[model samples]
Target: MQSSLPPPSRGRGRATRERSTVPRSVSAHQEAVRSLLQAPLSAAGPAAELPLARARGLVLARDVTAPVSLPPFANSQMDGFAVRSADLAAGRPLPVAEPVPAGADPGPLRPGWAAPVMTGAKMPAGADAVVPVERADPPRFPDASAAAEVLLPQTAPGTYVREPGSDIAAGARALPAGTVLGPAQLGLLAALGLTTAPVRDAPAPRVLLVATGDEVVAPGTALPEGKIFDANGTILHAALAEAGVEVVDGGLVPDDPGVLRQLIREYAPSVDLVLTTGGVSMGAYEVVRQAMADQPVDFLSVAMQPGGPQGIGTVDGTAFLGFPGNPVSALVSFEMFLRPALSELRGLPQPRPVVRARLAERTDSPPNKHQVRRGVYAEGTVRLVGGPGSHLVSALAASNALVHIPEGRGAVEAGEDVTAWLL
Candidate 1:
């Protein structure tokens, strides 16, 4: 007999939140990406003989304990006479006995006499105070060692002596785990006498990039009618590279489902993610969407102009994200989705810092879709690089930011506040 449960409970209605069917804008897409990537990732494992030189930008996997106390000894902090403060009177110069230099542990302080000490020298036993060398007149040189008798003024205990464990106590933690190895952290660890550190391995995700279109040709190649040089490939490639991703760079794939499917199947296992451009929309010759039909693909018409079409899914445990064919759209999709996703999985602070700027002039756009208009932000103002068209390469070349204008908004007047994502 099959195990059967009782009837449903009345409170089950509260178990699930109502799903909103409203089209998600570009901001919403970015928010979804931000939320989905909030899960923690595995950190690097510990190892002996770790090469710190090769661990730049890696997070520490374990705490670094101090093997020895900082300063490691009670030493002199200044070149002065080491003396017992008890010997100091209201008005008097103490007699100088032995001279102590750095690196040599001076024996116990000679009774009734002060010792001339150099900076970093271990304080003689029972030494209470240090009279700076300059403070002594004629400089005190004990019998036969030097001529002038050094006269030191009365001094106080604990003066000019570096106490043991003053910098860091022995067995103290030098640096905590999960610290991104920076110059300061490295220096601190070195100061703690750590020649090696345990750091997490940086998981560099292998990615396959495919730019698809019959009209897209390689740059510097002869252009035929109705064909343009591919810009999305280079743009997305650079973005992925900066984010520490390894790209296969499959280049352009003609609008052929057979080739696309074969490429997807062949490259999926080797790469952690497959990124494709174009051929996912409602266009008649859309090959990527057709080819991916056999796989788990989520076709989304995100409420964003220029880059509203997108596809995301998993094929045999390898993820695939399909972006629009336009250069600006592809880049915006990366900035909105993949960048933040990878940053989360890779344990970065934040993908990129977004700034707010004003439009330098008036511009009109669709009210239903959030538009990503390319522009240059300068002098506390943002000037549109060109018209709000995604195919304008010249405009994109001049742009350093993508200004996000929200949906249900039409013409943006000059000097209006707009959220800008830096490129």
Candidate 2:
């Protein structure tokens, strides 16, 4: 029978009734993987330039310097007359010169004259102020043949003029290294006229996924006696995809240890990591544990409920992570341990969003196990969705957060503060 007792603490000896037997803290397990993995398994190559359109969600490997100042030259910000501020100091009518439409380079402003400059047009030389069309007496462009003059109000220098380098300075850093390219970042690159950006060469990590157990069968197929659909494989594949990792399905392996070993050997060379669900716990059909018994892997129970049985080791130079078979346990294990580590390696955000909230009702936890309970968190309160069973796939789906109860703290009262991980 599977042991109900918690495993021994990682660094400490045996587990006692008073002390929790957590083999590793959530952080410790993540750190171990970081230290053990020498190179990123999914790396494509060295950093190289990528088109701006294809750079979204990629990290910038180098700083991007502005080739030219934003608004490269002085331009007009309003469709109005560009006049020397000194000439309009006393609100006097000035002769209108040739109109400067956007994209046209009109001659420099004639002394004692106004030039009709459209918005976004380059400011004519010797012009420092703009009088909006509405602010003019007739509020309309004068005829060039008529050589009309219009009255203007006193104006200050630099008004309505977009000065050179106002948005970004030339040769200045537009984006620093390690910036994750998003809409705003891509827009900036496009505005700067850059066709490509230097991004990290890391490709999405490739994983070989294996599901074990003779009693498990594929979904949408006929159900034989004492058989369950293979939920773990589907759940894990979806989770991996959502995390930006690539998965190569190894299909379902039966309880035979020799066949499991042969399957691992076949896929290990092509993948960066190997992830297997089921057969790592203290059960008669624990094929994964028995097959890897002679290898360097360590199969141990963590002091965490729903996902206590865990394994981390390398098989033929490929790292392998073993997760519990229960649907909820498998999903929670990925969220708590594998997700954070993989995200960090992929230059994505770490430690999924966590928030504090009050408990909606009383809850019980095992004496020496940290319990991750699925719950619906809203309006500053978190309510448990279902019982503490690890097979409650329906309840897990209904939850939007995971409420964490620390080990050795048996029960929590209603209205008490608790930590929750947002999904």
Candidate 3:
């Protein structure tokens, strides 16, 4: 049975034509995405206290202050003899006192003696310098029981001593807000004996994903005649998960406008975003396009290949983005537009790293549209992975980078520099 669709509103098709007549530049579309997100999502949320292990890759919501000075107390930076600099002035052999092993607390140094100290061991009171073991007259740590007098070269005070607060002062800021908690940042917190971190309250944006196509079926199920297994859902699910988005699968919707509209209306209230694959282009069975024909959504054809058809609108006040059905096109649209916009809105780091690299082979690109080609980038060189085809899912998997051939440039010669985004 066919479902009735709303009549197209005035200026809807004209808007699409006007947008398609002049292909939207990559930067322009990205700007539009950014403009749609006026403020960060965390602004409306509360900060969360997460354990250090769970805080990795999250932005800090507040400054982390050191509870105590780094190194806590004065300690030896090397395995040597902790002695008064005055004792080494005359080049006289000072009798070694008790040895200070790591985690051990020894008494103050004697008037004319030295104390053997291990690396990271606390320096005894009255000790002004540490003579490295190799610099001692015996060039070794003496036996604890034996009467060992080790001559030491004259050393300056504070030499080889890791003074308290050298790395970080107590109550001082160890990390500032908005800092992404990477390994070094987490290590700093760990060194300060912190078990948890106050991270930005950027909760994962819940998304409702709808794959619309009568010929598309879920994987692992028996394929009906003239039907293809759905890849857009799988691709988008994994991508959204990697981007830290909570996805509520809306399953597959057929080419029925009423069913699609009902699904959007059902999930829009609980989701921050709605994403659909297919039914956004200028086709007869474009159910999503027809359902939103009277709505605020604008469906247009972008100038780029593999992902030219695009739709961005709001369904029931929830942001909606419609991508092409091809696996590679859907994935590319997310990376090129949605991901960066979401990152800005959610305080997440930009997922794709863009870098310039020399092309390894000559390649041609269509004029007047930015061609994004999958490639293998290695050691400052980028080679095309496969032919330019939106259905080449395997090729996209084999590639590690996306090479951008700019508009107005038809062909790029080998060894020429081009911009690439690292996956």
Candidate 4:
């Protein structure tokens, strides 16, 4: 039976321990997780004035108006002679003015004379066109102070001249609030003479990560007869890092609840959230559930395959999230829940790109649960990688997309369209 939960949360909200064992819907659990994190995230805050180098991936806090137009003044786009287009009509040599190197204020052009302009040099006022040096007589700039003359070809006005505000006008919006800073956006700011931008570089929650279960052994060590390498810690750590969260590796904790409690009690003060992988399923040695029995966080059975079992709540004032022992389930949990919360709170433009694609193979899913299947998304189609099992790490590795099979969808046809999230 489904639990009759409230729209927001139930009870003192603090005392919202599991009142029923019935599974919650995937979206319901996602909202629960987000509601739990909203406060600390707000406490962590936003709105920082960061330099251009550090503002990438952050959202603009306010509209950035251009201080000066792009290419504030007219400039040459080539190493050529800046001349009055009318003066060059005769194709005759004219007295060469001072050489205008980049960054120099050469001066206004005198009628009937040409100014030797290097690339990006300010075009002398009154000069309307540029004739590439190769097209001029002798094809070389005359020595400064040498009383030289040069020839130029007739060219239309504005040739090779980058006019002011051609890219963006002065006092116009360069970027609007909520625009994520990227290379192109940052470059535009630099061109606008801005050294820094006011951005919403909200604090990335500091997570204390622990890998649980006696069956988990650190990588590079002996894999005993019954033990496997710990892929969860590495996977979760890498994912959290990519999302910009500061991760503190808490290493492995055995199935013993005392050790788990001690580790959390000690590190709870230093971290904004506590994350653990394994021991959340319905097994005899479910250490995470055993340890969090008294905490206000709820141990939920979400209506989702693979990652159905979840533990989310607070432990000693530190937010907590628990994922199943299976590698695939753990990652799916991160993708479906934690990643979205972090991205929303951090103000990222898009946490992940979701697309609709045609399925390349037939599949079956439970009608009551949402299913996430690993697939290879290409050319608007998604092909399943392996059997829909939670332990298929090899198949997960070979996949680049997560095909989302929504609740109530079952027995999907080969050519049916499905929603996919690009990794």
lDDT per residue for candidate 2 within 1-423, as digits (tens), equals 001213323332221212134466554555555544436543535788999888888889889999988988889999999999999866668888889989998778987889999999999999998889889978888887786989888888998999999999889999998788899999998888899999986777889999999989999999999999999999999999888778899999999999999999998988888999998888878888888876767677777888988877778878888898999999989887787667666656554677899999999999777799999999989999999999999999999998988778899999998888888
Overlapping backbone residue pairs in candidate 1 total 3
Best by lDDT: 4
Candidates 1 and 3, the one with greater lDDT? 3
- lDDT (C-alpha, whole model) for all candidates: 0.75, 0.83, 0.84, 0.86
TM-score of each: 0.65, 0.75, 0.81, 0.84
Worst 10 residues of 3 by lDDT: 1-10
User: lDDT tens digits, residues 34-124, model 1?
Assistant: 4333332233334434666766666677788889898888888888788887777745665667688888977898776778888888888
Name model 2 segments beyond 4 Å from true. Answer: 1-22, 39-45, 53-56, 73-166, 223-226, 346-351, 354-367, 375-388, 398-400, 408-422
Model 3 spans with C-alpha error above 4 angstroms:
1-19, 39-44, 47-57, 65-67, 77-95, 108-114, 125-166, 169-173, 182-184, 223-226
Among residues 3 or more apart in sequence or in different chains, the pairs in candidate 2 whose N, CA or C atoms overlap within 3 Å are none
Cα-based lDDT at residue 41, candidate 3: 44
Per-residue lDDT over 52-79 for candidate 3, one digit per residue giving the tens place of the 0 to 100 score? 9999978888788899999899999999
Clash list (residue pairs), candidate 1: 44-200, 44-201, 140-150
* Tens digit of per-residue lDDT, candidate 4, span 1-423: 012112434322343555346678787787878877777775534678899999987779999999998888899999999999999778778998888999998778999999999999999999999999998888988879699988777799999999999989999999998788899999999989899999876666899999999998999998899999999999999999998789999999999999999999999998889999988777889999889888876776888887998888899989999988899999999988888888776655667787889999899999988889999999999999998899999999999998888778888999999888889
- What's the true lDDT of residue 340 in model 1? 71
